[model samples]
Target: MSRRQLPSEIRKIEVLNRKTGKKVTRYELRMDAGVNQNTGQRQQVKRRYATDREARKALGEIAGGSTDGTFVGRSALTVERACAEFLAGSHSIEPTTRAAYEHALQPLRDRHGDMPVQALSKSDLDRLVNDLVVGTSPGHRRKWVANSINPMLNLISRVLADLVAQGKLTRDGAALVKRLKRSDKELQTFSEADVRKLLKHVENNRLGHAWHLAFSGMRRGEISGLLWSDVDLEDGTVTIRHNRVSVGGQVHNKDPKTETSARTLPLTPALKSALRRAENTQKVERMKLGPDYGPGEHVVVDEAGRPYHPDTLSDFWRELCVAAKVKRIRLH
Candidate 1:
């Protein structure tokens, strides 16, 4: 409503979780010096500290910066605006990664899309998480509801970290949210049998090509944008070099999910034979088209030697997974 001023508003600390007896000290940080980029209404920040010392430390951080250091006091911004900035910046990242963040943020936007940046609190975040697990939304997808909670917390962590780096908020805000842990029941990874059945189904009926690579731990885009140059036929080793991700409708190449993901995996004999057959089939089709043959060196091509979209390939993998067991090993 009205413009709020500097010297930073006071913080209130109370029980955040009555059941767990968890508590937090929160501060409504004000902007004494910095200017708001959008509304020109001066800058303000909302922060939560685990303790009084943490709160004071955050204050010193904001006060220490001359609108330029590790912290800044900015106001006149809304949660939606900050979210937009965060999402826009994530375009440089891989699509699957960006999608993960978006999945986490979706429920938050649906619930708290209207709250201003100056008024958000740790409790507000706690509520978003609580509602995600226990709240009911009629006709909503159950899987979406269940999986949406934790990553939203992670996204909040990332968003606050960015604000801290830019001097808008302090690290405490990020730190405060990261402590909200999901229950043991919330996490379910694929079982070894699940993996084996899924993989067998994929291999026998429709391996989806990329499906084989991802189950083998290849990053989605790595398998999507893979080229023959990155693979060694003689050695049967696939060296990952790049990934293609679509961010906001633009397909761009980026690095693998992690540096470690850019690795070499020996092709199984079955996989090698499959590839050989697939190539033989493609060579004949290319002849039928004669001059229409696309560029060579692209693996996992369709009947016409055309490369497949990684996203579509992902969906196909999901369906086939439902029908088949994925291969997995147990470690002692």
Candidate 2:
């Protein structure tokens, strides 16, 4: 019978020079770190010491720790590697959140892709903050810092926290980064008159369904994902359970952002009338197209029964605002 392989443990130690291998000034120790739970593959950890005696001592400590189940093995994992691992195993993360994390980490990957995670210092983080703040006007920089940099920092902090929980990191590098002071400018909204004007302007337009945003307080994704089945004409209520988000020009159906987001909204008079009209219009179009019409359940759809892309509503609203000579407000 074949001999069973031994469990992972310290495997080798060597004395070596920093410049040339002959003039031994330091020692390198290698240990078998056993199989990775995430990847189901063997892993190894390495450490360096100034002298062979110190290396031996450190190895003995590691062995004792391993024996007592107190060992937290050192990892040479880089930021890129950690991010990759986190994203790969994070199957429960929503698609939109995954996309946001990917976007936030792009700049960091470009700057410190190959740098070891343990080697990252506060100074390196300071440089990242400085780079973002530099080469922009004060007002624009403040807005950009608030909208972009803060979110990136927050994402990095979360990633670092996860690393600490995994025992791969001892500290969160982004914990010290302070959030930038955001401008006190409040979110702008359309007045009652503006809403009336917008509703009248789009009354005959195909995008009349957009009136739900103003009357029902539904988000853009919720509006896009709204289906006829979820609406009760008799009860005048619309149920929000799903959201359609556009990422990379593709539309995806996902759960609402929060538990509160999935709710039943009572339709106001304006919303009820608008939805009724939309239903009638879709029915007429369906009859005209006959078999050519695509079968879809969404309340907001094109002439051929294709659902609108999530971004399409925003673009349509922008054009309608321009044509109607109304102050533009973003579709929520």
Candidate 3:
């Protein structure tokens, strides 16, 4: 049978079959962004109808600027645009997470700047992430590289999801994002006994305060911003509501890493007593600072009574661990 020549404005609608990995047509008419909203987030939309008369009727609605009835094809979105939107929507993300997402996109953005939304196949993205996973070794990179790669893969998938939400992509970037695996050299969490022993060993170490906080599951930033005002001394409750994070090279106060992360934990007797001693020590140091005591709000501060960089606290943690006879495993 011969095919009839279609009008110039209408076009075919395409969808990718995730299982079979092929683009198949729905045999419908589609229009570009017009005066109305259509399919996902375009200024245009695809109006599918049983006949030319119905298609023309739908087109009239689109032309007249009413998105009353139109189907959006999911392939007409771009990855770069999606990434931008994703980051914008994620302003609430912790600084660490935001930084990680930007770092994850560095490779792809450098490579696929011109990739069209409709042209990005699942395999294409999967290959990019998979290449990162299998290309490096612990000998050259850090041992937990796969762990880093997996989180970045998840971030990329999230970016693609925003595209899907905006009706830009049907594949949803799942194929590529799911293949990123955890590295074999991921951190081995210390046993409870190890945590206790580490705490006991660091009883006299500078990290004694930090050890108490980490063992209690307070994130480094939360503990760093721990204030004397939030401690319930008589009740022995440590209320965690503040966090100090560094973003774009400057430190700022932000929400806790997650909702569950900002919680009140009951201080064990050990913790309570340790906190008292630490407070006494801090007061002595502050007194010696003479005229230099700066309000005395932050519970964890340097000798100068100023908040230390959260990252520097971690370095001291490693040093304390080594001094406390804790084992350091090197995957490299």
Candidate 4:
């Protein structure tokens, strides 16, 4: 006698009746979910779909996911969970970029962290962007949307793409989130008189040398990260090598953002004088602090000779602007 042949292991769609024997509007898909690791027994999973085509597509995806070990049931994933997974697995991201992503994504996480990834429709994403734009001030709405909301949406979209690649999501929801057209705004700057007033006001301040470099077009981080080794008082030049950055309130020294950013900058007469004054002043501070002083090679430092936190310089600049009665501009 011939051996009995088994049927193909393909999922099937079934039409079911309600408890009252009335026909339901949707179709049900049932399939074996493979053997359970703990129980060593076959498990089953079921899904409901609005149409035969939907059922077939989902069934095909489920079968493929099982074979590839990428299967993630719809009920088992959320936006927050997906984000966490993505962040945890993204080992190649730089520290500064990762920190920016974390900060930018916080609002989205607070709003839709628990929403299911598969359930986030285009309308939902549109509503999120609209709500964020409405909540911002009229004068700053464009900036806030462009810098914060748009970046957050892009990051979420990246996470969704990772989920799709892993078979957790059928498509990226962020693809539907439209980017806003950003118009160019006039750059804010201080007048020559205001600049002179600001410089004069900071002449006696602890960050006097930093203010001089700031006016010379050196970025805040580059100024903060300066070392005596990187400065040539005789040549009146400052080399842009390292940059000190603040992320989540912590300070770190990293290389300049670009190769062009590492070029040498000529110092003005006032900057040369300021650097000399700072050098003399730090000598006195080192004498007073003795072993407690930790200036190392950094040119810009606090009273204790420790390097200044990058963000603290901005705060000081704001206060100095107020004192000088000048229009406050960003420290960068």
Off by over 4 Å in 3: 1-82, 89-94, 136-187, 191-197, 328-332
TM-scores of all predicted structures: 0.60, 0.74, 0.65, 0.80
lDDT of 2 by residue, 163-276 (tens): 877766667879888877777878888888887888888788776866555456888889889888999999988899889998877888998978999999898887788888
Tell me the deviation in Å of residue 128 in model 3.
1.0
- TM-score head-to-head 2 vs 4, winner: 4
lDDT per residue (tens digit) for residues 100-163 in model 3: 7887776666556567756766677666655555664322232335666676667777776665
- For model 4, residues 1-332, the per-residue Cα lDDT tens digits are 97333224333344556677865567567887665443456667677777666776777877886676556554557778877778889898768888987766666677778987788788877876777778753223443557677787888889888777765566887888888876587889889899889888987986788899899888989988989999999988889999998877888889998889998989899999999999999999999999999955898898788888899889988898899999889998
Give candidate 1's error at residue 160 in angstroms. 4.4
lDDT of each residue in 120-233, candidate 1, tens digit only = 788877766555556553223353333455566767777777765665554534347544444467434677777666656656443345555666667666776788788666
Candidate 4 clash pair list: none
**Where in model 1 is the C-alpha error above 4 Å?**
1-74, 86-97, 135-150, 157-178, 182-220, 245-252, 318-332
Worst 10 residues of 4 by lDDT: 3-12
* Local distance difference test scores for all models: 0.63, 0.77, 0.68, 0.79
The pairs that clash in candidate 3 are 32-44, 33-43, 33-44, 39-72, 77-117, 126-176
Assess candidate 1 and give its TM-score to the true structure: 0.60
The pairs that clash in candidate 2 are none
Model 1: which ten-residue window has the lowest total lDDT?
A: 323-332
Which one wins on lDDT?
4
